[model samples]
Target: MPTHTPPHTPTHTRPRTPPDAPPDAPPSAPTQAPWQAHAQPDHREFDATLDVPYRASPGARRTISIYLSYPDQGRRHRASWQLELRTRKGAVLRRWHGAVTLGARPFTLQRDWDGRAAGAAPLTASGTYRLRLQARTGNTVITQEWPIALGIPPRLAMPAFRPLATGATHHVATMTPIPTGTILPSYTVYYGNLHSQTNHSDGGGDLAHCTGAQDPQSAALGPPDAYAYAQAHGLDFLMTSEHNHMYDGSDGTNPNADPRQATALYRQGLQDAIDYNAAHAGFLAIYGQEWGVIANGGHLNVFNSPELLGWERNASGQLLADTETPRSDYASLYSLMRARGWLGQFNHPAPDQFKVGATPLAYTADGDEVMVLCEVMNSSAFSHSADESESHRSNYEAVCDQLLEAGYHLAFSSDQDNHCANWGASYSNRSAVLVPGDAPLDNTSLLAALRARRVFATMDKQAQILLTANGHLMGERFANCGPLALSVRYAGAPGRTAADLTIIEGVPGRNGAVSELAHTADITFTPAPGEHFYYARLTQDDGKLLWTAPVWISQQSPSLLCAATN
Candidate 1:
């Protein structure tokens, strides 16, 4: 590849300043910093509160939001919004009143208490409170309340978005300062999604007629159309991972269907993706299999495995797809992927899913290399929206965090999982890739990014967030000693500002809840020597969120390192 300055048009990345460059400009005065100064710990007083949530969650706030849309073809819908924080006995403590909009999906908003009563009131006490959403939609008004607690563990918070502190940042792509002593990568962010279902596997319904998920093998569009839709809608790539067992035309129960025919259908889907990408420059249309059933097993996306793996067969005992891997045996599936150098993603992970030896999320060493991504958030898989205003998305953040804590080196992805023909249009959320700045937006470069865990999950299509430790980027593992500086940088389209930024820390094998470590532009501190992982969460003023991939670090003293080498 030829080296060239990464132009800003493709990615909003700025190159690093040379060390000899002038001193940094002063930062603007802080605007009511959300965090209170903490008492720095003695270097030895570490890990004492690593598992304690209260030690980490004081004064924390969750980004709560709601989005309303009208898709009735030029018709108008309206909603006015306000909020009230009330005591358990129903006395209002804080009331955030009133922002109204009279349009469609543009009604995206976020609200949180300012830690006061009105203007200059003292801070609200730390206690459980009712977060009420007071809304007036068109001709009606309604109020909804959820239990919220200040200075409480995140999982117990009300129905607000607390992007799990589960993941890390990139350096080259962020154009942000490197934490003095670390080395990180310069990557360009590419936006797209990796999971969707088309007519190829009980999806790809026609927008004109389809309502939700279609009957297996009975939709109008296929993989190629999905690619076209995604590309035309401004995505850099889209992977349509079809359900493997659905190729037999009857959701794996029609024993009379020709297994060879089923295999050919799978191949045709693959060719469709190839042909689509060949015709469309810079847009990757990936075809792969979403293998497994959600009943007794969970689904995993095999992105590079060209040969379909399945257990369903027809009356002649002929195998569907190209092979007959035993169904629901994830351990065997993971081993095969390892041997074949294939990559996969855990889709909508469940506690009872992806088991080995009947243990869910059991740490499979072979799978540690094979599965690199997990779906942290997903829109309703069968949503029929095509205008990017889908509101019914499920938060798998806790589940994805569980995967990382379970000892899997997996990054996060926000999945569209579109059963509707809308492909990438059903939602604005995306799985972003930190593709090398010098590389083209193609399948190869994108796959390389995923293989390196250079990725992040974003709920907004236009926002960017990255985390880096020292000079190391998110999704990277490196050895370090001395001071540790973790930096998080963010940017969005014009007029958007970062409202909340948090650095979350966790130990890979601790299987404990993650903790909020810091709330600053960047963090600089000396931590006790050991293995740990850190990532960031950025909530934009518009209530959108971005979760970067986490960087894992193994720290040791120089003496220990030298001894180990000897």
Candidate 2:
């Protein structure tokens, strides 16, 4: 084991202000900000150390950093290195390749391995493994191997039923009796980013080849690193929904040389998520998969599943069979998901020719019961349009509204659909769940809140909705008469105020147009009959927007009936 000296703590140097400056003058900027540095390593002594533990946990990362002395003090050394994980039998499990160059002074090279073979290979079995580091310089080679072990720990189980604390009052006046299984109403909103990726899929970063660069061509953050990043950014929950088939070796290149390797990689990634959630208490990590079909079917992200379910396509790009179903049966897939108590959501639903062609409801006679939500707002630049055009921006809203009209009853959610490792930093979208303020911030509670439809999707991090219909919060279903009273209250991020608020209401196939409601933060309204679904849209002075989950109102208590059936 090499002795380790922690990375230097950055020192902030404030600029000096002029003596004649006024008291109210703005403060000077810091002289040396951390992000301002170039890609070159710091000027320090040569050091090599592993940041990982001796007994590595499965799905966790083992990081190694190398600081090399200035290239012979004069002659430059265009050096490179390779890091490999080998089994006790001397067979290579995974390998990472990278370039290393020394500056005028000592500089560092760092990379991480997530304990799996490259390009979606299965996680290595628990046993003794050797991490081999090879440094090459003009025919002179230096090699070092360190023995380590890997194992999986017991997972932390969630409580079956944790009752909501008493003494909380409901804002909505229930026309019917509250159901026995309904989650309590004392809920507070928690923010999270539901869509993201690690190196397990097509996204970049995390590999030795990409690390240490100012901007790597690929994603550098692994699952554990991504989780920490999200927590540091103030997110309550983070779900990295990697593409299910992205590692399936279907492209014919067969990077792993084995078809099963892809599935193994996907499973390892999910396992990593579980370990992270168990290790972190306050911050919740949810496991999910983004099922994509570039040829036609579009994309769907299924969450909270005990195992993985993926679609299989033929060589011609046509659907063949899924993990379980014999044929390309959407209903069968939904059945399995429902059986497992899983939740499926439409990922960046297309508006034009790229449309999924089949809405989530189209898969089953009871899609509303299975497909819990749809992405009304996705922040991916590739999937989302900057201009709020009908073809691009309005298409998502239109599709969601159309589904609601058709009786799909799907809640609206916003996600970054982030391929880059940006995670919660993408302030354009988030999934906000209304959980009991005192409820345990665990997977069970969070999923329960989502299943209850106590959620709102927002584009701005600071935006919030205190919406109620005859006292029921957004996403709640209620039985009301011809005229229903609706209340909407908006809160904007600091330095920003609500500019306009609009209410949209309609039944499926009817004229669903938007009407200006109010410019203030709060407003009340009475809607006419036949308006079965209603939702509010708020625009901020800064041009950021937010859309709340729809509130379904019916003359009959269909919501209660729907809940009963589910």
Best-fitting candidate, scored by lDDT: 1
Screening candidate 2 with a backbone cut-off below 3 angstroms (N, C-alpha, C), the clashing residue pairs are: 172-471, 204-218, 204-219, 205-218, 205-219, 205-220, 206-220, 405-508
Q: After superposing candidate 1, which stretches have Cα over 4 Å from the reference?
A: 1-186, 557-566
> How many collisions per candidate?
11, 8
Q: What would the per-residue lDDT of candidate 1 be over residues 462-543, giving only the tens digit for each residue?
A: 7777777877778999887767788776667567666556678787777777777876657788666788888887656554
lDDT of 2: 0.53
lDDT of 2 by residue, 1-566 (tens): 01112123121222221123212333464563322211121112222222223454446566554433332324345556677878644588788766555334444555555666767776746544556666564443334444455663222121132222211222322222222223335555677877766665544343223212112113456677778877777777888776665454332122233435655666677788789888877687776776644223445667876554544443333322225332224566666777777887775553221132353335354445667787776543212122221111211555566566656667778775544445666444677877766566677787777777777777666567655676677788876643355656566566655544666666743424433344333344445544467787665544456777878876543455544643
Where does candidate 2 have its weakest 10-residue lDDT segment? 386-395
